[model samples]
Target: MAPMAEPVAAAPAPPHFVIVPLPAQGHTIPMADLARLLAERGARASLVVTPVNAARLRGVAGLAARAKLRLEIVEVPFPADSGLPPGVENVDQITDYGHFLPFFLALKELAGPLEAYLRAQAVRPSCVISDWSNSWTAGVARRVGIPRLFFHGPSCFYSLCDINAATHGLQQQDDTERYLVPGMPVRVEVTMGTRPGFLNSAGFEALKDAAMEAMRTADGAVVNTFTDLEDEFIACYEVALGKPVWTLGPFCLCNRDDDAMASRGNKLGIDQSAVTAWLDAMDTDSVIYVNFGSLARKVPKYLYEVGHGLEDSGKPFVWVVKESEVSTPEVQEWLSALEARAAGRGLVVRGWAPQLAILSHRAVGGFVTHCGWNSLLESVAHGVPVVTWPHFSDQFLNERLAVDVLGVGVPIGVTAPVLLFGDEAMRFGRADVARAVSALMDGGEEADERRRRAKVYGEKARRAMEKGGSSYESLTQLIQSFTLQGGKQH
Candidate 1:
């Protein structure tokens, strides 16, 4: 037995990923979930955020600690002179629409500091995962000699349409004229009015051009959607981009417990117990959950129409009204009167709502949504059909996917898209809202069929995130690839 035992090689260190998210609630929430998922999977994940954004993620940080996951929140100073007021680090905090462009462009300033941080690190990151909006990360990754992956928050369907439109171009006569979107797997129609407003701005075009260039240089993309949800579109997108696109989420599902759900996004306007208690008292599949996301700005008239619509539908509901929308005396009085009339049947939350928790509740039968991708995926993951009311940027396309392709939603019949500034004339009224709600919630064969389809999709979404499922396998492969690359670099 004289031969000395062969020494075993130590396992390679876990791959470390530095995640950079755009400072918006919708964008950051899913990215936060991705960081948590990576940490849980035995990788070191660090989220680089501004001061305000870091504060918003405190709950997520706590979740990671309890789970014993290697998740870190790295704070970077938000660039000043962005035209936004002090302490206004996020899109949701911007009071004026004119400041939006300034806020967007100012984020590019982060590249210098981010590069410095990477260079100073004792061990280089295995990869840099940045939101597609943060296009500046591409240069930083290049300078640091690390791989980078873009994270797209929108549906694969919307992304494919965006790419095709940019490639083939659209010929439109006017804002109302409908044109067939070129190069889609399915027939999708769009009106010039429904096109994203950013497309009209020269400044935004420059930024967009940079983002597209960054996408080309990046190693690949990871989307916050499951393969089962958009398999065809994902395949088409991969072919178009000629890069691997990984589908590793319904990231909201990573928050498995009540504590995690309640704290998943922005700060809650009301206590979690209060919302849960209200839902607990309602009958199963009885409450309609209403929210238009954090950044959507609607005038007081729109709020009143929504209020009257919920009252007219005669259904129990929970509606999230941004505090900014009700600052005027007229809107306040109108909301008060509506709340009084619909007492015990409807609840209106004034600011941020525990959206994930509300959607997860059994009492939530349907959702009145603005077709934001995160909201759409959450609704699908919970088996809730929707009344679609899209507002601006990618929302109209997302609505088409929900209503036409998925068959789990009914449109509220806003034929024209509105701008982000809430300056456009109101189109849909109370009656439109009531009709869509009734179509979704009323007990009929059609309504039941919609609910059934939603349930099936929800089940498939959950299954895809479990071990041996499509998303699970994709995530495993993604980490393994990074690990191997990291070892080579070492």
Candidate 2:
């Protein structure tokens, strides 16, 4: 009944570009920032998203709209491994380890569906900006003659250190905690860098390998951290990757004010308002805001130790405790015990907060974080000193940069196996955790000096992201490169 066959017209050039991310808030945010940059250079954006992440893509889409950019969304299905609870369509629902393994696999599995969608788009994209999970897209791009852009939503320094460690084996060896990497600038890539009182644990070897593979296949890479935050390191990174590494972020630059939409996308009714109110009530340098960051797990003992440490320090504090992290009745009750004792002085948040905003608030003096690269940048960007508890990956190096190099934060906790199980490990449980907390809370005169220095760090971060700054210039150059036809390097 259908008149089927017709002569096909010559295909026009592909659409502007398609960005495929790992479908997490961390990955989505940076890609959205890049999409805005692409649009500014007059390139249309086709953001390929999985069904679970579609709402988030739409939420970020609102930001592009404000810039008068027409950003399109194309959907792909999550791999069965994602373990989306029976009928749950949203990526936000899978919060625990029960889903993490599967979700990680799903992110990688999404390559095929995304490739199919890219092939059928109205206009072909010049290149593909693929996130960590979708690194497989690089192969697809090569198959179809488009460039592959691997996105690393963290500091260039972190990536540099990770690759360095993989090459030099920075993991703890027979209780020798720190290791020196052969790269220039006399670099040290400790298993968990302990400059003095601080102990950091950097794990997740599986992920480092995956990232290196992705980078190997891609034409270029993008790191969502400013050049100033990791100057010499990004240069080292250019050598490590054997390609150009563009330093673009703290990618929340183009983020919109649509809290409801962002909350929907993030799937946590993150009561950012309450956080601000708590900050408002505190005196300057009075409150130490504690957040383990999104991916950092709170082992019950560590959580309890943190609570007791805050209480013993006698500092005014607001600890953002997520119900999801506790995940059990016993842990919830234990948390309540801490809550009841410290009722008036401390507030525990039920969900997430606008972290950078909270960190920047006048009343907030210090931050306790998991040392995710984004969290590191936020602390530096806001001039909020840190009590770093690095859980995994390049976070250890970030902690090194924070305390050893910049003097912006102090480190606590050792999660390496020997450190956790050895003779000194039990001591680590008590001494290291409490000491780091106290240093940041300093009742000493040095607190004022630290605060002044922190403010300077924040100002520098602002300048870097502003128009005509190094980060801005890097972004502009990156956009120009992508915008050229024939995909020529020159």
Q: lDDT scores for all predictions?
A: 0.89, 0.67
TM-score of each: 0.97, 0.82
**Candidate 1 lDDT score relative to the true structure:** 0.89
lDDT of 1 by residue, 175-223 (tens): 6577777778998888877653234555588888888888888899999
lDDT per residue as tens, model 2, 1-490: 9899998975443237788876666557567667766676566777777665676566566656766775777777766645557634333455444555555555667668876776775445677888755656767887667788888766665666656655665544565765565554645645443321111213434654565677787888888777666688888889887888877775654443545224323544456676677678889877888886655555666667777888877777878776665778888998888889888788777666666566667888888887777777777777888887765555666777777777777767554422221123323554565677788877576655666777887777778777887777887777666655533221
Q: Which stretches of candidate 2 lie over 4 Å from their true place?
A: 1-15, 40-42, 81-103, 167-177, 192-211, 256-265, 415-434, 443-449, 486-490
CA-RMSD of model 2: 7.3
In model 2, which residue pairs have backbone atoms overlapping below 3 Å?
Answer: 14-124, 15-123, 15-124
